[model samples]
Structures are given as structure tokens and as C-alpha cells.
Target: MSQTIHINRVGLVALALSLCANAQSPQERSPIGAVLGTSTPVEELSTKASPAVVHIEVSSYRTSADDGDEIKNQTLTKRQGSGSGVIVDPDGYIITAFHVVKGARRIRVELDRRVRANSPAGELLNGKRRSSFEARIIGVSKEADVAVLKIEAQGLPTIAFSESNNLKQGQLVAALGSPEGLRNSLSLGVVSSVEQQIEPDDSLVYVQTDVALAAGSSGGPLVDIQGGMVGINVFSLTQRGREEGLGFAVPSPMVRFVYGQIRHYGFVPRPYFGVDVQGITPTLASALGLPTDSGVIVAGVGPGSLAQNEGLQAGDVLVSLDGMPLQNVPQLTWLLLHKHIGDRTRLEIQRKSSKIVLDASLISEPSDPEGSIATIDIEENLVAKLGIVGSARKHGTAGPSPTASGPGVLVVARLRESDTRAELAAGDVICSVNSVPITSVAQLRATIESFKPGDAIALQLERKGKLMYMAFEMD
Candidate 1:
């Protein structure tokens, strides 16, 4: 089973204050006048920012007939998801994190109250509003983890973009999102740092802030005091795999890049290199007799790839791209995705005893150039976690069972001595794992990884119209 992470929404202010008051007695309470000074009022910002924020929900369906299962039936299931989005146009286009509505079959939008509907109080509140709308996925950038959505609603309020280039460290900032299930939540903090690169895969310039964002805050806007959006909150710092208060956001430049592509072309055209690279450390470079702190070492180039055709070979050190110094692997990857195909780029590198320059034309994904740009390779680690590889059944499903069809993931390759292989036959169709429906390879792995070795695992399989239970040790 694979590991899973989820976000939670924060409660409303009145409820939070009530909870705090309940924790204390009358004597422990502070004077109301003194408490005002301790709090920085954000009501004005909230009133303006809430209109630009929205909630998203999605649903999907799967059919057993598609999986080749004997059941030959169909099942409909709806998945609900919540994330923050910024209205980018008066015509109702929205921008959000890609993971928010990935694989969504249906999407629904909820705008601030009082915009088109009466406030919950119904007192003809002038500033309070709530409106419901429908939305659809317009485009997605898997490499950049951004998605654009559009709505039919007109005259929508939009947020203004500020120059992230001028953002300074230690400046005050606000994070607005639906944290822990509460909508239109706001938190205050200061910019901790700027342009701090933390991950090799995170090449988009970022602004690190000390905002107290909790779960369900991804895709929220990080705004300056003037209420202009400077960045989009994406993720938080995790030490030893645990989340900390320090959060990071995508700077306005990358946001504008993705937004422009989606607005003009309806999709982001990511440049593909068809090659994999490994970082070169100073010590390793010295030992290899190469200039220290210069270039990456090509590990593998895909067959018929742009890099392979351009004479990019393994063990070569990549020093620069388009004459700009390449400090790390992420910088190179960013350059590749930063433009469209037909854009020419240059690579400077060292091969063994000599330096050379390679000029190349960027290309789209070979098979589906306009599809998702995420590189696809068999994840051995992810497969090993499942202990079973499934092939789409000739007339059945290849995924885990109990999915309205029956149990067991179709067996493509079963690891030797695996528990499932011992109790169930190779060709048998598994319907359930201890009564849980098996859906995809991901679902199978996630379930298995949730248990430890020596844990009891059970399966229900169908072989020739007879259902049987096979029990085994997880290890």
C-alpha cells in the first residue's frame, strides 16, 4: 500500500473563540480592550479576498466491463475534493493547484455569499454573500502542478497580481484559504525568505513565508498588505516527514507563465528532453577530473529522445543552458518546461577530457504531445509495495477486487513467494482484500503498505464461479 496524506479544514473564528473561552474560567479571561491590541484586524482583507476564493468538488465513474471482469457490470462513484482557487478573469476563469481536481468527473464551485445569494443570516447584509456555480477543467500542467478552470458565471470578482520580483523578506503577508473544512479562512504571517530553493524538483521560484496554513490550504492566495496576490501557497516544510509551520508558495512569474498558456492555447506545452540526469557534487566532480560545481551527469537517455538525437550521452557533465549557469538539476528541468516546442536551446557540457556545446530543438511528448507532460516510467518501488502486478483481464478488470465486480487485482506478474500467490491461484480474480474493494494498482499498494510485516492479510477471489477466502501473512 502507498502512503497517503490529506488536508483538514479549520473552524470558523466564532467557534474558535468559543473553544478558547471554554478552556478557561472567568478569572482567566483577558479584558476585551486589551485583547484588541493583540490581534491584527483582517476583516477588510477577508471581505475583499473571499470573492476570489472558491471551493471545488469532483466525481468519477468506473466500469467493470472495461476491466474484462466476468461481472460485466457498471458502478458509479463520486469523489469529493476541496481546494482554494483564485478568480483570474471577470468572465469567471479560475487558477488553482493541479492536484485539486485531477481525474475529476464533475466539478462544482461555491463563491462568497451575498454575491448572488442572501447571507445565511438573511438580514440583507451589505457585505456578506454566497453564490454557487459550476466549473470545468480548462487545462493542466502536471510538471508545474498547476491547473486552470473556467466558469460560466459573469461579472465575477477577480484578484490583482503584484510584482513578486519586488517582494522582500520579512514583509507582512496573508494566506487566505479553506483550512480544515472552513471556507474563507485567513491567517497572517511575514515573509520568511525569498527565492529559497529547497527541492530539486521545485524549480519554480518561491517565496518562503511563516504563515500558519494547515490542511486544505493548497492553491490559496498569498497576498501582500495592499491585497495584491504575490504568490500561491503550495506546500509546507516537513522535517523527518512531519509538517512544520514554514510554508512555500509559487511566485507570480510561474503563475503568470501557466496562466498565459492556458489563456492563449488552452494548455501548457512543456518541452521534453527525453533524458534523465543526476546531480554532480563538488567532491564527485573533483574525483572525476571535471570542474567542480559545474554541470550535471547524464544518467540515461530515452530511446529516440530529443537528447539521444542531439548526441547527449551518459557520463557527460552539463554546465549551462542557453549560456546561463546551471546550478542544479531543477534549474535545467525548469528551463525545459519554461518554453514551448520549436524554441531552440543550447547546452554546454564537458565530455571526459574536453568541453563542447550542443544546440538542440525542443520537442513535445512523442506519443501525446498535447497530453500531460509528466514522464512515465514503471515505478518499481511502487509496484513492489503491491506484491502483485495485474494485467487487464481479457474480459475483466486488472485492478483490485470488491469494486462492484469482485475481489483481487488481475495478475500480470506476481512476486515469488508473495502471500496472494500462495493462497490464490495465478489466474484467479480477486474481489476483495479482507472485504475491501480493490480498485487500481495504487489502491492495492496503499492498502498493503498500511500494514506491517507479520500482519494478517486476507483476500476473496473468484475462480470459475466459486468464491473462496485465502488468508496469508502480509510479509
Candidate 2:
């Protein structure tokens, strides 16, 4: 009886051990197994996503030296700049930073994880050494700073798309690209906010994030948690020309919009305005018979422009466009962007002591006039490019009064690299050349040619809406 009881006990122990083994076995493991149940980290998504990202290189040539002789030959020199790009389709269509391929003599696209070279990761570290796939420029919009390219290849991996609409503030975001020419570099951050407008023109709609975007990351995709692209890593707030932590992105919806327009129209659908405007102060609004603290004051309208065609004139306070209230420049930009060309909208205008309404159809601004004419209008490009600008008139407007103000000339616009922009402002009429009266571009050109590179000229001009004489030496 004792032997039988001991055997029974051993059998019971063996049964329990077998059950445990069956529960933990690969075949049984409750279907998931311990390893399979683990969550995947975000880096895995970046790894797969990086394969679709590409680096674009462009080369160009420019005149190196020019001789004063009209018929003399000039030497040409090579110039180069870099930006980021991504593969959007399996058909070899690539999207990249427009400024990158702009004016490029040649363009080349490099796949991210092409080959493992001399480095420990067996990957080619130097992008300049690796072979680049040739690409053709498809479309470009500089104001939006986006471009599209096409190459000859297939079976390329494409990133999944995510909507910025669903992206929440402070959600994690990742950036993958060859930032600063370092291949396969990854940086992580969070969505700082949504709908941030950082452009000086206030025309661009952006997704502001805390992602680290360097010079080379300009066109890289901003990835959300699901590895889907939320935005394209773009400009960052800068101080003294150096980057601050605040990074901005072109939202994915805008990216898709840009791509669609480029594919369909071969150019961006930029909105236009024919009316000159300035922010209205409370005092100014009251004087103009408008409600204080509302809308932009219409200073003038361009002849034969969309505004003039719609019967909009000077002294009309623009209160709104369409059904949307126009509180500021950005508000107007947003409203116009919602509609396309040929779309008609009603505008609320306060003229004299009565409110009026008018309908206008949006149209594209005409291309800049060709040829170099002295009286031709040049927009204030110097403020963004040269850090200084000089306009020929007050308010940057043209009229018969400006031509008759003074014959010498005028520095109507200036971007101050010095004390203040007002120190050398627009309305300042240019007079005298070495204490000589001058008029017209021809006289100004002749007087300037007579002096050497480092010569001084006595000048007289207006300042603070009052005429003051001052001298500026020429270089």
C-alpha cells in the first residue's frame, strides 16, 4: 500500500510539470509569446521611414569676374548649396526644398541607406563620395519654398501620411535626415503648437514644433508617433542669423496642396492684392469715420488692378473679405488662401461715413515687367536680402506728386543695418552730387561714374517727414 501511494504522488508531480511546459512552449504560448507581446518603439518606424528620405545636391556656375568693357569676356566660377528631400511615390517622384535645386546646373539624389562602406556600420559616411541618382526638376514655388523632382526608378519605399489636424500640441515628433551632411541622423522633439505663422509675409501656414532642424534638414519629413509624416521640417526662428530652438514646418496639408498644384498647374496658385494698405490706429480709424480697433486702412489702389476693377478706391477701410472678418494681415491671407483663382468674394468697406459692399474675383498678379527701365517699379526685396532697402517714395506708392517733389532723386525705402530704418527712410528726396543739383537716373549714373570707389558726396534729403541735409559716402 505504501509503494502504491508513493508512485501516485510522483505521477501527480509529473502531470503538473507537463502542464507548465505546454503553457510556455513556442507552439502553445497563448499565441502571443512573451517577445511578440512587447510594444515597438518609435525608432523602428524611423528606420523604415528613412529609406524613403533622400539627400539632394545641386551645382551651378556664375560669373566670377566682369570687365568694365561692354564687349569684354568674364570668368565664370562654380557655386553650390544643399537641402533635403523625400521620395513620395514608387514611380521615382521626389519632393525637396525648392531653394536647393533653384538655378542648379546639375542635380543628384542619394538614397539614405545605400551601402555600408568603410565605417563601422558598413555604411557610406561621406555623402559627397557616394553615387547620386540623377533627377529632373518638375515644379517649384519659391514663395512657398517647395519643389518636386522626378527620377527613373521603381519599388522605392514611401512614408505613410498623417494629418496635422489630428496632431496634438506636445505630442512626440521625430525628424530623420542627413542634417548637416551627417547621414541617417535622427532627432526627436514634440509639437510645440499648431497653426503657427512665422513668415514675415505671413502667407505660409505652418506647424510649429520643437524638432531640431539644421540647414541640411530643410526638406525632411516631420514624423509623428505612427511614423506618418505630419510636416516638412523647415525654417527656424533665428537670432542674429543663428538658429534658435523654435523650429517651424510646412504642415502636411499644405505640402499635399503644394504637390497637387505643382502637378496640375506647373506653378503655385499665389493670391494677389491690388490695394495698398496699412494697419489702422484707433485715432486714425476715428478720423476716417471707421470703427476704432478694426481692419486695415486702404491707402491707395493700383491702376487697372483687381481692386480697381472691382471699384475699390483709396480711403475705403477694408473690414472683411467674404464672410470672414479681417482683423489683420494674416487674417486676410488666410481668407484668400481658402479660395482659388476666379472665385468671387464680397468685401466689407467703410467709405466716408457709410459702409459699402463690393464683390471681387481673385486673380494672379502679372509677371514682373521685363527690361531695365529707370521708372520701373521694384518691390522691397532689399529688406529680406541685403538687410537694407531704399524706396523711391513714401508708402512705397507712385504718383504724379512724387515726380514733381524734387528732380534730384529720393531714397524712399531703407532697411536699417545701422541705427534705425527711419534714420534713412523712404520719403527722403535725394538732392545734390558733390554739392551739384542732379535729376533723373542718367544724371545720377553720370555723377556716380565720375567718382572713384572711395569717394564722398554731399547730399540733402528729408527725414521725419521734414527735409534735413546729410551726406553719405559711397563705396
lDDT of 2 by residue, 81-172 (tens): 57777788876777776656654567788876552212223333356333357777777766556788886666577886689888877666
TM value for model 2: 0.59
What lDDT does each candidate get?
0.63, 0.60
| Cα RMSD, model 2 | 15.5
Best by lDDT: 1
For candidate 1, give the lDDT of residue 386.
42
* Candidate 2 off by > 4 Å: 1-40, 61-78, 114-131, 199-201, 240-243, 271-273, 276-300, 304-306, 314-317, 327-331, 334-340, 351-353, 368-475
TM-score of each: 0.62, 0.59
After TM-score superposition, what is the CA distance of residue 155 in candidate 1 from its true location, in Å? 0.9
lDDT of 1: 0.63
